[model samples]
Target: SAVISQKPSRDICQRGTSLTIQCQVDSQVTMMFWYRQQPGQSLTLIATANQGSEATYESGFVIDKFPISRPNLTFSTLTVSNMSPEDSSIYLCSVGGGAGGTTRNEQFFGPGTRLTVL
Candidate 1:
């Protein structure tokens, strides 16, 4: 099991501004993923941060808009660039379980950082 933490449980930002959130893990992990949950919406994978490599973003996301950094095995950061009211959502960090030959892919999510744009 892995424990994760995210900064700014909630924030209100104006349009066209950006916010960078930090994520820390208790143990080393192979992949760290970012997600966004809008009001009354399902969680959506934003990107996957792999240490020593550039982040792999999901469709409709670009590095210029949602840059991610994984400096080490246990820490990462995600920045929401050029924000808009449409970008208001709860951001979450997740880590998958199981190691070595185990194929378990269970993901544990953070409490989430809720953002409201005005």
Candidate 2:
């Protein structure tokens, strides 16, 4: 199993500002994924951070807006480039788990960094 943590459990920011959240894992993981959960909405994959490579972003996300960095196997960071009330949501970092060669890949989420854009 993999454990993850995100910084700034909650933050209130003014519009036009940006915030960078850090994620740390207790163990080495092959794929580190970032997600965003809007109020009353399901989680949306932001990007997948593969070690020693550029992050692969999902549909509707661009690197300019949400830049990601995976410096090593156990650490990564995500930065929300610009601020807006619409951007307010809970950001999460996750990793997969399980046994055998098959990736049992269950996403273990952080408590989430709740952002409130004012």
Candidate 3:
């Protein structure tokens, strides 16, 4: 199993500012994913970060607004750019738990970074 952690457990920021959240894994994992959970909503898949490649973002999410970097197998970062009040939500980092890093595998989530835009 992998132990995952996130920086800035929670933060309150003003509108139009940006916040970069970091995710670190204790062990090297093959597939990492970024997700967003809006208030009272289910988790939304933001992007998939594979080491040595550009992140693949889901629909409704763009690299311009949410840039992701997978510098290594054990770490990744997600930056919310030019954040607005609507961006206020919980952002999470997760890694595939099954062999070969497939979607069928279970996902281990990091203690999310909560952002509140004022």
Candidate 4:
């Protein structure tokens, strides 16, 4: 088990701007992922940040728009570029439990970065 933390729990951004959110896990995790949740909508997987490789973005999400960086297994950053009213949403960072288990693993999520684009 680990403690996951995100910075700037909530923020108000201007149009055409950008916000970078950081995620720190207490210990090395097997996997790290980023997600986005629109108002009144369910969570959408943004990408999976690899420890040493480029992040894998999901459909509809591009690297240029949502650049991710995972310097190590314990830290990652996600930048939401070119913000707009439609980009207003809660961004989340999650880390999977460490290895060495045969049972199902649970991913722990950070509080989340809430951005309201104006």
Candidate 5:
């Protein structure tokens, strides 16, 4: 199992402003994922970050709006470029265990940063 951390756990920002959320893991992980959850809704995959490569974003999400950086095996950052009411959601960071039958195969998530755009 991996432990994940996120910064600025919750914040209120103005429209058109941006916010950068940081994610750190306790151990090495092959892949790091970013997600967004609207109030009372399920998590939506935003992007995947792998060390040494550009992040792959989901459809409707772009690098310019949601840039991701994976600097090493246990750390990554995601930036929300322009804040909007629509972007006011819970952003999460997660890592999954692959090829293992243990809980490592399950995805462990950070405490998620809740953002509110005014």
Candidate 6:
């Protein structure tokens, strides 16, 4: 199993500022994804970070606003650009479980970075 951790457990940022969240995994992973959980809402997919390629952003997200980098299988970063109060949410990093077990479709998530834009 892979253990995931995120930096800066929580933060308060001024509007118009930005924050970069880091995700690190103990083991190498092929598929790493970013997600946002707004207050009282379900998690929303932000993007899929793949090594050696650009991160694929979800429908409602754009690369310019949420740039992502997957330097390697064990590390990835997500930057919230020009953040606004609406961007306040819990950001999470998730990695798909390795194959060959009942863990299919299973994913491991980081503790999450809670951000509040004021």
List runs of model 1 lying over 4 Å from the truth.
97-103
Listed in order, each prediction's TM-score against the native is 0.93, 0.92, 0.93, 0.92, 0.93, 0.94
Score each candidate by Cα lDDT: 0.87, 0.86, 0.90, 0.88, 0.90, 0.90
Backbone clashes, each candidate? 0, 0, 0, 0, 1, 0
- Tens digit per residue, CA lDDT, model 2, 34-111: 999999999999998888899999999999999998998888899997889999999999887442122675667777
With a 3 Å backbone cut-off (N, CA, C), the pairs that clash in candidate 3 are none
Q: State which candidate has the highest TM-score.
A: 6
Instruction: Give each prediction's root-mean-square deviation over alpha carbons.
Output: 1.9, 2.2, 1.9, 2.0, 1.9, 1.8
Candidate 5 least-lDDT 10 residues: 97-106
Q: CA lDDT of 38 in candidate 4?
A: 99
* Collision pairs in model 5: 97-104
Q: Model 3, 22-84: lDDT tens per residue?
A: 999988887899999999999999999999999999999999999998998899999999989
Query: Candidate 6 overall Cα lDDT vs. reference?
Result: 0.90
lDDT of 4 by residue, 1-118 (tens): 6678999899999999989999998887657889999999999999988788889899999999999989887899999999989999999998874532211377788999999999
Which pairs, if any, clash in model 2?
Answer: none
Which candidate has the highest lDDT of all?
3
Shift in Å, residue 42, candidate 1: 0.2
